[model samples]
Target: MKLNKILVYVIMILVLITSCKKDIVAGEVQDTEKKIECEEVEETPKEIVIDIDDIYNSVDIDIGYVELENLNEDNVPEIDLEYYPKDGDFILKKVSDGYICVSLEEYEDENALEDYLSPMVYRFNENGKLSWKKHYDYKTHVGKIGQVLTFDDDSFIFHIDSYQDWNEGRLINDNCYLIKCNKDGEEEWTKEYSNSNRDMLANILLSDSEEILIIGEWKAKDGKEYDDIDKGLKEELNNDIVITKLDAEGNMIEQKSFGGSNDEHVDIVGYDKKLGIIIEAISFSNDGPFAVDIIDKWNNDFIACIDEKNLEIKWIYRLVGGKYTTNNRFSINNGMVYMIVTQNNRNRQHSQSLITIDDKGNASKLITQTYDQMVDKFNSLMILQNGDIVIGEGNQYISSLRIFDDTGKVKKVIHDINLVPDEIIPTDDGGFIVKSRRQIKTVPQPIYVSCIWYDTELVMMKYDSNYNIEWRKTYDRYKNNPYWDCVIPLNNGKQITEIKTDYRKSCID
Candidate 1:
């Protein structure tokens, strides 16, 4: 009887041990499954995660901000005052006085100018100080003046018209001119262009022969009188590509016009110094309207033309397929041209396109990247040394920074640059600085450019080549000022900023 009892006890003890071992094994299996799920979910886009390094203190340089008078001093936010507005175009130039001149296209007013946005010029001193400013308008046009080119130490030149036709050709008084102004915003001289019904200078840069090449458009009737656009108005629509060349002393050297009764425009132009030719690209229509929202008409093509002093085309090649929204820049290398365009799929508003132009000016789609990435409208892109392309703006995809190879492959996905890219300057060493934004919340959140969300204090940061934060500077959005000018790196670790009359520096330890 004693032996039988002892056996029963041993059996019960063995059973209990087995049960406990099974429970331990189950817990281990469950933990393994959980870890696998996390790894799979990480494949998601970076846009969903808040970067760990986005809002950190700077280490290298201290940021500075300042405000100047002669600006709108109303109920305005700090960041938005000097920040660039939507569709806000910019031109960074070095003046003879060693001052950096940054120009931003005028923005739309809530009051709509009631007509159109007028062009306002903000000037900065050599030390990145905001000096005097001015607003210009035409007697008839609905908007203000546009970008100005620094000609000499005391004066600059800009383009505008009295008839603000909103890209429509104007007649009689509809003309484009290069107006010269002194440092105090005083008018010095105005060089006008006529014969072409209407026109506006889109951009101006130095030419091969050390001349000033102005890229713009001019419109005239095929004698059809543009009856197509009557629309009950007596005026007609004259669409043409008008290019005017000027000498170093500000004299008109030549002018040329292109288009066929239909609509055409030239967005940019440059002088091929090595080839000793003036090259300009203009879009012309062979067919009528387009069915695709992203592309122009089916028959529309971009022609690369090289001309002589006689204003005649020497060689021309018509590039096909691409749409008009492509803000492409052409570079002439060793007997080849590099044409890069910022493109996206028809399904979304943002994407990337990089094309290589052969010696014959033919476009080969070298690399393309398209995904479910959402980005702000006015982003900036620069070509890297290794032939990679870097883009900056508001990224809606995974993380923040995306490095792409020439074959459309993503080399790196940076959720946080540790700094925002306010301006992306492609360095020779193959890195970039991000001028990003930061803010302080006050009021009901004021309107902002570069971002749709409103904020009071906007922080502009700098990033290194490896996406490291170099420095971050914060500025106050002012009431009257509605645009952020430009942020430049200074010699000292401390940087200088030119906000609307409020120039101050920040200490980043």
Candidate 2:
């Protein structure tokens, strides 16, 4: 912009001198005013039109990567040992005066896969070119990083839970860590939090005052594979909210565990000064009818609760999932809670619940809808800037981004993506960026990223916000993608995007 102004001034001076026909413009004040007006218009910076195809022309995913379970290869639904099928990363945030994206990348090394947390962050120039890259311990247990968060312009934070190797530590060796990485993709510091039994990193809210509030699971279980799947994947039994508060420099200020031994999940948020209370929407298996069995958690749903400020029960709200409920979804915004639960009668279906729990934890069910194609079975809550909600339908195929007012009425359905929207970001302008992918048919059966955008008009019929033809970019990763994927809008009129690539391949299971 400064350069634009300078060039404009120079052009104006040149025009004035040329127009000053010494003989005719000596007294022409009108000409001087016209020149000034022209100069002002020239001083304004023009919105530079950019094209996507010119930027990220194409990508080549390294061969022999293994993350995807390989749903299709040699015509079989189940996967063999060779398919590196992993999901793309989700979550995008503003970085510095620009944007920093935290997507996933895969690298295979038999010795390296043990560390659990390996694939790291890659920095991009303002023009969206890959600048440098960083990685975590590509050694022990192959740390599964989650919830990559940007704390500020020059740095970011993410979670890492190292698994128990064949060597040392307890059965489920774990410690939740809050790491700080520099601009050049360097780990500056890290704060570790753990308990005697089982502690798994879940989510975090980096505060406005540079203080970070970390939320996760503090579960206790044995070493059996069934026990491992129950706690790690199914999120069954051993429930406790693991809360760790730390400053910007990675110093743990306060740490505690809250919740019962059944269900405790934390979706965190914070600014910079204080670590806010945990608004945990809990589901107890103890309630409901007697038709429930320990081996099958398919019949569990109860009152959701919030655990915060030590083990204090801030509030509790009842959520009825009927007799044939599979799972339920809930979220908190502006001290309010919204939930969605699935009901199975003849076939499976879902309903979105908009509820508000007061300070005492008493919940008021406001709106409930069994409307669309399929609500996201995993999660269906997105709060807009104006307090409106954009909810999804089902996990396999999120039919629409249904809008709801504060009163919880189905207002409208913005851009509809047939598959699950892995990520949706509200842009500064009255628009949004949606990033998702679908399974494709190929030898390795690649997954293609499907990107779309919707303007303020709230219509899915139209989707061109640029002067170019193709408004979205797609990528195909055949194997080994065990990380996040996102589209970053940078300040320099470019999109900073990352895809899963570069796998080193492991020798054993």
What C-alpha root-mean-square deviation, in Å, does candidate 2 show against the real structure? Answer: 22.1
Tell me model 2's lDDT, rounded to 2 decimals: 0.45
* Best-fitting candidate, scored by lDDT: 1
- Candidate 2, backbone clash total: 44
lDDT of 2 by residue, 44-76 (tens): 534343232222122221222222232222321
Candidate 1 TM-score, C-alpha based: 0.54
Model 1 per-residue lDDT tens digits across residues 384-412: 65666565535322126566665657777
* Each candidate: RMSD: 19.2, 22.1
The alpha-carbon deviation from the true structure for residue 238 of candidate 1, after best TM-score superposition, in angstroms, is 3.7
